[model samples]
Target: MNSAVFYSSKTDMWATPQDFFDALDAEFHFTLDACAVKENAKCEAYYTPEQDGLDQPWTGRVWCNPPYGRNVGQWVKKAHDTASGGGFVVMLLPARTDTRWFHDYIYGKTEVRFIKGRLKFGSCQNAAPFPSMVVIFGGEHKNE
Candidate 1:
């Protein structure tokens, strides 16, 4: 079976590559992972699904790679609100610029970095079908 089919049948949770996380960590010094399971957490402090990351206090520099399913809007909204409250949040999101959440929360409020190519998430040998982006909120406005 192909990687895409394998992944699709198995899980929607795409673990972020450690090297990618390390590169971002060098700059952001992320203190909390707003969304993560124990096995995939990039930070010492993290919120698992059961913890409902959206309801948690997002203090300091937070790294969020929310689930790519239907509820992504909530996560994006939470990130925006947290940033407005003075916390910094960095998010890894699918580059779906056409989505409502993108226009509503990310367009004017954050600095966006569109990744050059699809990423090989986790241990998958094939690259992600969709492109990805990194968005920063509540930091010094580099895009503005």
Candidate 2:
């Protein structure tokens, strides 16, 4: 497995500002400006280097919009590990069907909330229509 830092940019770690984070900013009690590019952006929290912050075990509701970079598989795996260890992990990930992460970690473990369209990312807010999925894991497992 690759290091968590590989998933983020060296210059700017944050990628997309999550929608869920924006909806309930007060509840999280954190600021989005310093971490992410946009302010009051309706999104979940962006992924940081595990060395920097993601290492700790997070309890309760958790949000993660992992960086879409070289070693994204590692981050996705980490999210799955977080979910498995009794932590709520909500992730906004690109629908990369061919990747190993999609097959092993995501495919059969959880129910995916498929987005109707592509999400607008940071900076240019590019309209990426490559299909995305919101994988909710270890939150409320009433069905199972």
Stretches off by above 4 angstroms in model 2 are: 1-14, 17-51, 123-125, 139-144
Clash count in backbone of candidate 2: 7
1-144: candidate 2 lDDT, tens digit per residue:
333332233422334544544643444443222112234223344323433324555554555665566666776777788778886666677888788889989898887878777665544335664677877767564422
C-alpha-based local distance difference test score of model 1 = 0.86
How many clashes in each candidate? 0, 7
Candidate 2: residue pairs that collide: 18-42, 18-43, 18-44, 19-42, 19-43, 19-44, 21-43
Top of the candidates by lDDT:
1
lDDT of 1 by residue, 1-72 (tens): 234432442666677888999989988888899998877889999999899999889987899998888898
Candidate 1 has what TM-score? Answer: 0.90
- Can you list the residue pairs that collide in candidate 1? none
